[model samples]
Target: MALLLLAQIASGDSGRVELIAHPEVGAQLLTRDTTRAIFAMRQRTWPDGQAVRVFVLANEHEDHVRFVKERLAVYPHQLQLAWDRVVFSGTGQAPTRVTSPTEMRERVATTPGSLGYLATEHLDERVQVITME
Candidate 1:
């Protein structure tokens, strides 16, 4: 794990970005595709049928851009378009946006079934890390 993190850093991937979830969230592991779908707001519930609450930072934020690109394998613009389409078409709602990483951490920690990304340095026992495959 240390080697992989080092490699990501060496490759200019600010690997500090991590997928975090509310402590009460049931999921501990998820496939990359499922994670993308959740972030894209296509999957409204977890595999176990629990409702999902997705949170995000502003699209143009560096961590947001990096998390979209490096983790979800999508561009920030594309993710925005997806959210816009759903919201405009009245199908789904966009993820709640937090103003800063501090708010992201706070919201994710307090909201059940919530998921968001944050830098590792901001992590605390209040939230759980959701590992992606």
Candidate 2:
């Protein structure tokens, strides 16, 4: 099931981005809406109720741009605006901003309840790939 979903997401583009979550996040599949909400910092927990820790690359990073545009189906600035509102309003916190893909993978792998994205080539067993519905 996981492999099928992964192939479907990774099928079209050579430069695709995929979700990499902490091994303990406890969800094999998440609705696209839920994933978006999480990245937007609107949703604070996983389906099983673990506090979510979202990680993202700088706005200008290519993989970050692709993940927002392709997987989340939102523009980079749109996501940034949502985050700005949350932080500016003091309602919630922004997702952790990592400097590079290696940092993204490292943080997500070591942080429990964390979620992040990486190019297919950077993925390894340290983290689990989650499929978006």
Candidate 3:
């Protein structure tokens, strides 16, 4: 079962997503752990110490599920549970949720200190891609 899960994860679905940040973020690369931390709301600042603002598609969104599983190596349910625990315990807040990829691009582009994932084709000059280090 574990190997099967690993294989499935190793072969994520057809779509490709990119980690995108506001142009002002000034970060060209981030380690997988750091990227996960930011998305998990566990790390609140970038290496440069700017506050990190996280964005996400709705929990049920296909891209959200794919990115969480493929990039973060976890199921969407796990991420949701973590967010719920933090929110209920009053230690952190849930990420801003956008309904569509278009909204995601707009929000991440206009919001400072923002980070989110988008299908590669949705990426544009308004935001820069953060390569996994």
Top candidate (TM-score): 2
lDDT of each: 0.88, 0.89, 0.85
After aligning candidate 1 to the native by TM-score, how far in Å is the CA of 24 from where it should be?
Answer: 1.1
Q: Model 3: residues >4 Å from true position, as ranges?
A: 1-14
Better of 2 and 3 by TM-score: 2
TM-score for each predicted model, relative to the true structure: 0.88, 0.90, 0.87
| Candidate 1 segments exceeding 4 Å error | 1-15
Clashing pairs in 2: none
lDDT of 3 by residue, 40-121 (tens): 8899998889999999999899889988988888889888988898899999998999989999999999999999998765
Residue 74 lDDT, candidate 1, scale 0-100: 92
Residue 131 error, candidate 2, Å: 0.5
Alpha-carbon RMSD of each model = 3.4, 2.9, 7.6
How well does candidate 3 score on lDDT at residue 43? 93
For lDDT, candidate 1 versus 3, the one ahead is 1
